[model samples]
Target: MQDKSFSPERQSAFDARFEAQKIAFGPIVFQCVRYAWKRGMLQALAEAGDTGLSVDELAATGRWTPYVLKVVLETCLSAGVVQLRAGRYQLDKTGYCVLSDTITQINLDFVHDVCYVGMHDLDRSLDAGKPLGLQALGPWPTLYEGLSSLPEPAKTSWFAFDHFYSDTSFPAILRDVFSSGARQLMDIGANTGKFSRAALAHDAQVQLHLVDLPQQLAVADITLREAGVRERAHLHPVDMLDPAAPFPAGMDVVWMSQFLSCFSEPVIASILQRAAKALAHDGQVLIMDTFWDRQRYDIAAYCLINTSPYFTAMASGNSKVYESTDYIRLCEEAGLRLVSARDDIGYCHSLLRFAKA
Candidate 1:
């Protein structure tokens, strides 16, 4: 499909006013919707069906005062999440999605529990070139370093958001990763060893090497052991940022999934160079990430673009959701060639396959 562009001339003045108001009240509307969903207001409306429910009925059912119900419902109505007719409130298409869509729920929780507060430090993070917002969660310089230790709702939301995006692609990715019949595969940034366990299940003959930080490896160790794949799994603990440290060598395939986006260009180049050196003569390095510019739809592109600020404020400040061209150029700098590029593999991900130059 061709790229989508906004054309003000094609829209009515009313449409322009609507768009302007939506942007102006975006944050408030978001919170109102979230509150409505959490407080059972949306569910009550959805279940009310064609006839819907009046404010008095909803207030009585939810045991909330009509005054409180009116305040939130009005905001929801303004956002097109709900509609009112004959003093009855009904769920609209957007409201139903807000209540039932898994992706929507995940994104909402991630923003509220993880990114919202930290985002206030975006300007400071940009000016200082560091994850200053990370202070809200912990003293760690970046989110990755403190992933295992993030407190309460932030920890839960962080893992949910991270896993939801990557887990769906694993079935297809496992087939692709093992297509060359690679026996020795290295999983870089093997957070929780989810991919390693999947690989072991897919092919019992394949031995897996998982490389990651010591804290993350600890979590992966338990997961692999419980899955009975510990016998075939080897763990290597190393700080990927340390340029002097080298990757374990002679692997048939080096797999990085949603991993490289956690670092800046220089760090990514350094990591790729290490992977290139570690690969066997016939081996390949596979990188799977959500490259916004390569997305098939504008919605996917929009989500990916908005996620860049999370990296600036909470993740490693230097990294972002990169364009595929950026990764291709970095591969060349690291003495590797991009052998293949595949887009639209599971959700919004793109895979770039590289080989030693």
Candidate 2:
């Protein structure tokens, strides 16, 4: 949970000039480290433990020759992902995380399989305010529409990345969601029905309504049905981006988990306006999402703020992880008032409750 990320306080110890070179050749080093992970060099070093292994010893134990091993190891050594002392190489903390940390593993795969190739067109995506990088996957207008069709490791990695962050947070926040004794709950952006599955199972009396695009609804329908919770669910298929589209009405709670960040500011305002219109007089709208500025740790903030480029080039060009203030102002503009807010929810989420002003 702690990171050795560069801090202003570490200015004396962390050399800015050396860091600049790391940025310059980052793509090569990234791939080399990835190659090391996939090729089992880092794992070998991890298993080698305190004594470590000489380059010759490591080569003797593995298929990689000394030259090839040195190529990967020397780069990692410079990156501080591995260390060399007394002619033996060992996995550094960063290297160990690369091999075993779930978050790091998920993120690495997402970037490599989903974003790496498409990121080349980031300049074009930025200039046009479109997900030009999505072209790398297929000819779908957005990633959501193409998700079901994405091929191979890309498709699997995409779902894994999306689910890892979301699925972990549901159990921790479901209690807060149902504490009001609400029987009607709406899940907007019900990706794969994970939240709906949790909500339906948590409270038997609760009737869950799902609103999403037709394509995603198809996937969620099967998931909910398979989970045996589809009996209490209603599926509403509509694209909220359509200005004329109306939200399903009279809900006790409207949930928009990891949803609003898929839009631009004006589009978010419009969606919130529609959600506000659909709310019962006393209904609350719950938004659970990652706001980069709200993170307590620098590493979380670092990983989050960097996700904007992925949005620009791959997901939705104009939508990036937002700050809480941005959402607060948008909600207020839509005639809603923030009633309750909780932060540091499971897996870097904040739950904000809003009611009609």
Candidate 3:
């Protein structure tokens, strides 16, 4: 037997290369699905449903070209995203995760339908040092605000994206944030009140204050009633970005998940400062969402697509992901100290947890 040892420098280099490769793999898989879906392969299979459909029928009755359809279908099958049998194709879980009407698929589609459409001008946005894509309405506001002009099916699709992202990780992050025990918590941008329900589930004694758009509060009312938590939940229709004077004093915790990232840096800073005033002496603030990591992944392409001019014509631009360091600095500026920070991977998204100073 031989014992092999590598130098510390060599080991570090190998680990870094492997990490980059893992990150690149996500884009490759996305490209494969995007190419196939653009060519009508995914839709054809979806329309076929459980009954299934053959490539021949897709070209004939389905009106797809035989050669190109076959190439796309075969590629999908090879990727384990679809199944082939007796010349027919059916969706596999991977395919459904990306193509079905489920929340996960809708989230993925939002990237393709809304974000990537502007990727062509990524270089221009990078050079400008400000977002320049179709969604960029101003230096503030998120991509969600611009979808108001979108028609049905597309509008519904964006809601699904919102649901999936909010539900997937916000619950667990809240659990971790309030592990010390929370008696009263406020959820900023609390839509449908589900995140509030998650907290309630974790601790029955905790009272929930749900704040959201006025129209959405109606929806949240129904959700809380159905969940049997209305008795413990208070619905408030107010812009969370507005002044902090309305917030109840002495809150045990403040939860802002997928909320603060929607605003510009100045707004985010102000929001934190206001939130600090509402916290109890020992209360903690929780921020749960994705953050940019220059070392972990290549987000340059994401910045380009998000800031493209194409989106500006259709919707307002989204706030770019800020690094954890920036988030920490914002908290510190508000006179709060970060007691804990943890990063985790969720179903198809990223999770970040922060505890108040």
**Global lDDT of each candidate:** 0.91, 0.90, 0.65
Clashing pairs in 2: none
Ranking by TM-score: 1, 2, 3
lDDT of 1 by residue, 73-119 (tens): 99999988999999999999999999999999999999999988888
lDDT of 2 by residue, 165-197 (tens): 888899999998987777889999997899999
Model 1 ranges with Cα > 4 A deviation: 1-9, 12-14
Q: Name the regions of candidate 2 deviating beyond 4 angstroms.
A: 1-6, 9-14
| Candidate 3: regions farther than 4 A off | 1-63, 66-104, 112-150, 294-318, 348-357
Rate residue 280 of model 3 by lDDT.
84
How well does candidate 1 score on lDDT at residue 223? 94
Report the lDDT tens digits of candidate 3 across residue range 1-357.
Answer: 123222243557777786667566655657667777666678768778977788778788656678877766776786777898777889777886666545445645666665564555455655654345544322334344444445455556666766765677765576575776889898877866778877877778888887666666777788888888888898767665566436666778888876766565776787788778878878778777665442233333243234224333323233455666777788888878877666553433344444455
